[model samples]
Target chain A: MAFISRGFHGRRPSAGTKLPPGQYETTGFPVLSAGPTPRIRQDDWKLSVTTEAGKQHVWDWAGLMALPAESPTVDLHCVTKWSKFGTEWQGVSLDVLLADVETAAEHVLVTSYGGYTTNIPLADLVDGKAWIAYGYGGSDLAPEHGGPARLLVPHLYLWKSAKWVREIELRPSDVPGFWESAGYHNYGDPWREQRYQGD
Target chain B: MARAAIPGRLGDRLRWRTAEVTGRRVESATAVTLTLDLPGWPGHLAGQHVDVRLTAEDGYSTQRSYSIASAPNGRSLDLTVQRTSGGEVSPYLVDELVPGDRLELRGPVGGWFVWRQQQTEPILLVAGGSGLVPLMCMVRAREAAGSRAPFRLLCAARTPSDLLYRSELRQGAPGLDTTYLYSREAPADSPRPPGRIAPEDLVRSGWPPDFEPTCYVCGPTAFVEKTAAYLVLLGHAPERVRTERFG
Candidate 1:
């Protein structure tokens, strides 16, 4: 519980209401997942890949992770404007994730906790490779930062790294998420400084 | 066939420079104001911020976003950075960086809390400490555009001297009523304002009933969450109260 609280704030601010460096500890890391950590119940928790033709193929969590788990080290950039580099991840490449499922769709919309969603192209999510990250660095991903699994699109930006992911709704059309809908760019491209409205 | 322009920089990133710095008051403990250096600037909207990244000799880097303190009239970027005791970034910004310092910043982010003169929605801005940065920008833009949309700015600070844009806000007085809620400093016989803006206090000092004003509250996340919850309880639509929470 202490760890989870710290995710919101890692360290006490030496400056006025400002957090110190990442090296500084805030609370502690969360021992438990705050939201639902999806189960790999082949029977219940199945991966449904929807194609542009509206065809949906279901696979259990294990089946999904089993596809092509590649360990790729890449930079993870957050909409918060901080970028953490050289992180390792494992999962089926989005290309492989959709390899079995067919789609003429140009775009894909990813959704997560509290209606937060982001849209990217089928090509973008799989630009190099996207992951349904079940592990981080080397260990099973801690729940404090989305566990049991989450989507890791290494290319676009971090907000697209949906946490506490429950569903992967493939769409031929594009739509934004809670943050994106509010004012953020549909595709949060850091290089473009797609930070706010009118940007 | 969609090829992104190859960025010459290692990450293929866009960079902003500090054209110059104008020394504003050191005011008590906080260091305020620096006129930015820029070539052709992409004018920023009020309530937007820019990322300031400093790379040490060893390439150790620190970056944080700060709301622009100056209104956009094709002028320089104004930033107010407050020194935090253990802060790796803010202290360095105020003490280490010099004018013409080669820096990298990118921004003009945040859309929810933006203040646009053409929109014409009555606005209420609530800020705390250095958190007042963005709201101050909005107030200036509104004033510069000669807007008459009733804007009410309430800034809460620990001490009188702790205020970041005290003089600026006063110098370019806002058309919207501005109030300073000081928690630590007790000003002479003014109506008893709560030492802290609590739920009860906010409810008692209710928003006027005339216009369904838009409220943009930016400050510490804790303060924003609590105050927003209170404002919702006081009858403001949850969506109507747009926010940009800073930590």
Candidate 2:
């Protein structure tokens, strides 16, 4: 049970603007990171997808750019209780990237350049549900906002879209990543208001 | 990779505790510091933050995160709120909330961006705008512990008037060096011209990269990005520099 503060009437979003429970709309994009931003030159960047059977598929910056890209304008919901709608991003769909990869894994541990990691179900990454995004708006994604490329999973909380994403390890069992181990929900679903472990 | 120093169940830390506003102080033109008294508050590190929730009579509610401003002090804590134009919760926190008002807040969040008293290494705190709040807590913590850790603070603000904890910073403590960089306006006796924090400003104010100081950078996204990038360029290890950025 929650208690109401005296005379603390908060801002109620205008009707018809859809937002998840316990979230408010924000015009500006906020940056949340565990540590300093990693500076990876485009030439030195590489992304690898390791399967449960130890099969590895690697893609250099050039290889990533060679793949077809899609422009996705999706809504973002952050566990921090801020939401942004219709954010434009350009990236290669996970379906296209994983089309040739063979995997029978149930989960994936997404890793980034700065040692940041997040876990997600493999089912959530396929079927045009996610992308490896490198561009935001029109230009290259800023380093502060995970430049070069980031995993774009709009269906879940923004943290599910790992920034500066570099590797994906498919595993048989679910293992909590950085934030997940630090008290965030392992399988973050913004619509369900699953921001923490119990919720 | 700093984990939560407080030992307890995650549920307890995330639990919403009722706190009454015991004291209030106007920090700046648009910022105010409220002292909240939580009856069963768990202690938190210097750089941790709290999530504040406000509910209306009609069941509408919203929440915002604010950094802890005061050093660990039993059940009492300080949160400095800056009023952003058209902001939902900040306006109420800065302009409307008063003493004796009760608010629900779940505390001491974010283990990564925290400063523990056990750390005796030199600390470099780079703050912009209201980012000074958490760093100020670290400074106060150092003083409270009587730890002689060398602390250098490089604060960038639009003007001196925009700086929080102005008088407290001016008082100055031993082993703590603070450099003020004003972007818009500078005082008459100010040494440097008014401008944004440049790489050279950090080089002069911050410890040499060779010293291996733990750097804490907090502020707006742009400020934190630029400052952190400059620090890395100056040869500081990326792992040594921790950041907490706000929109």
Candidate 3:
């Protein structure tokens, strides 16, 4: 994107410390979806991790709940330029979910219930960087916000989080999915303002 | 139609521009339509939206997205704002801003939700509240292009007073059919009772899914979700259903 003068941003001066350029802080959570929200029941929900080589690891709701989980306070930066700070989420870390799986893939393609998919570097999912969260703000994650388990990659733009996530596929090469193929940056980093292709 | 140029200049799609308010029209008690005159404004397609930014004198700025309510006029566009209680931007745009004031905006964003004049498929547009703004462009574009494509709109509002583009919609266009549902207060002598949009309403008022109409749904989150779900449940292909959301 060509540089454009943003004029004065003197108000909310303290927010500049945490917010990325071009983003504002929002207290009320906004719901943005391309289509309808899917109602996936916990009894029918399962998450799977697949390898490009064809190995698959699946976990049902009970199994996921039994695993040790953490509630972390994180900041979410949406590609649309809203940043919600200190949001809390509870879920199993990707490190824990992928600990048993061995793969040579360098990229991960996350899939969700509504057929939404987004790609991210495999490195971004490991080492405490991400989770498949089922709780938010001390309550069960609402379906409107990608409940029944959504991928929460707080480090990147919120689109990469992949709401209602159902599967994660490890691929040998990077592959763009959904928004990535539809003009969004293949790998979104809020701080760098990598929002679209060739940004 | 050259795909309406996908709404903006490269590298400037997200860049903010100063749009001078040229005119205003009160659409309803709670809504006002603002005409913006932009320099070298890249034309936008029906169903696309722009991000309107408001900066207070103290440099406190915020922005929200609103659909373009005007057809492709090349030099200017119209954005209709509905005042939301306690909303920072909507109230200012709907009640306070004057014709000479300048507003910052960026868009014609989202290429996917647009309606191209050349498309010949039957269209089923379902709108809730102010969601009618974007779909109205499609209706206007159909008339502007002089295309006779079969088009229908189902608009749901709290009451007749809550409807936007009241006169224009009432003075129908060729091939345009509409059904108005009042959830809170039905007009006297109205045939339909006051109620929310239901599955039966979709089957009764919309093009049958077998007709393969491209469905465009826009509204508040709940309304869009429920309406689109009903469309799919009625057998419209998921891929054929397009939606835009606002709250």
Best lDDT among the predictions, by candidate number = 2
The list of candidate 2 runs beyond 4 A from truth reads: B1-8, B11-13
Please give, for residues B1-247, the per-residue lDDT of candidate 1 as tens digits.
Answer: 0111111122222344544444443644756566676656667778777776555544344457778888896747778878777666666666665665544566555444577778687777878777788888888888788888877788888877787766766665645677777787756764655487776555444365346777778776656766676776677765566666654
User: Highest DockQ: which candidate?
Assistant: 2
Q: Give the residue spans of candidate 3 off by over 4 A.
A: A1-27, A137-139, A192-199, B1-13
DockQ of each: 0.10, 0.57, 0.28
lDDT of 1 at A64: 69
Please give, for residues A1-199, the per-residue lDDT of candidate 3 as tens digits: 3222133232362534567765777787877767667779999999999998899999999999999999989999887767888899999999999999989999998888878788999999999999999999889999989998899999899989989999999999987777766556778999887876666
Model 1 clashing-pair count: 17
Writing each residue's lDDT as its tens digit, candidate 3 over B65-184 gives 788999989778999999988665678788777788877887777677878988999999999999999999999888988989999999999999999999999999989999998999
Error of 3 at A126 (Å): 2.3
How many pairs of residues collide in model 2? 0
TM-score sort, best first: 2, 3, 1
| lDDT: worst 10-residue window of model 1 chain A | A1-10
In the range A1-199, model 1's lDDT, one tens digit per residue, is: 1111101222222443332232222332212111122223224444456666767776676676657678888766555645555677766666766666656678777654333456776777765657777788799776535666778875665667776555677776776655555455667666665654445
TM-score of chain B of each: 0.85, 0.96, 0.94
The lDDT-based order of candidates, best leading, equals: 2, 3, 1
Q: Which candidate number would show the highest TM-score if scored against the true structure? A: 2
